[model samples]
Target: MSERTRYEANVCVLLHRAGRWLLAVRSPGVAYAPGQVGLIGGHVEPVVGPDVFETTARREVAEETGLDLAGVDLHYLSSELYLGDAGQPVLTVTYMGELADGIEPRVAAPDELSAVGWWSLAELSTVENCAPWVPPLIADAERLLRRR
Candidate 1:
């Protein structure tokens, strides 16, 4: 038998508005898929806390997009296995979140994120060359929104 593939837990945050959402442009130098547009999130650290999902979600948004969890209405969406190069799996726990007014993210960490901005679902559908796994995750989120 061949070596089993490895998977790591990650967090995904959906910042949504009136039928729109936020997407971040990943830095071009990251070992992972670089220069791809994706939801704001990252690996879930083991020490994140008892509420690991929430902690990681909050931390990820802060790290990548500078969005604090304050007043952000968040709901658990789904867990998905995202296949990257060499079939490496990033098992992501996703959340559907709505941001409150009077808050926005800047390029606080240039090394990790090149840019961040909001986009409508229709606009996202037309974004060329997004990370391969992102489209599926967005579809799932859209379905979840419809049910809500």
Candidate 2:
């Protein structure tokens, strides 16, 4: 018998403001990436409704950060594959957007996140215990920023 390959579609938002990006610390109790810093995102819930990747990105950001992206212009950043906590393959679509002036993120989902804050590229690179993909994502984000 062969093992079945499982896959999941997820969307993440790299919320930027004043040269900083918003990041969330996953709660220890969470199933994926527990206690690691990562972008605001989650698996697309097809049961609730079918949505475009951008809508899923926006929804996940709001659900995790309490920040409204109603008027914000989100740009497609990049996409990559990684293993989930359960070791299932995950395809993640990433979007970048600038938050409204003076807006900040809070822990909207305590059960999912332990903390939320803004981090600069340097900080992101040097920070210990960040999600393994985060450093490379930061580089991608920097390239995207340079293109703008």
- What global local distance difference test value does model 1 have? 0.80
Candidate no. 1 TM-score: 0.83
Per-residue alpha-carbon lDDT of candidate 2 for residues 1-148, written as tens digits (9 for 90 to 100): 9989867999988988888888999999987678999989887876655557888888888888887789999988898888867787999899988887778789999999999998888887788878877878877887888887
CA lDDT of every candidate: 0.80, 0.85
Predicted structure with the largest TM-score when compared to the true one: 2
What residue runs in model 1 are displaced by over 4 Å at the alpha carbon?
1-7, 82-89
Prediction 2 global C-alpha lDDT: 0.85
Candidate 1: clashing pairs of residues: none
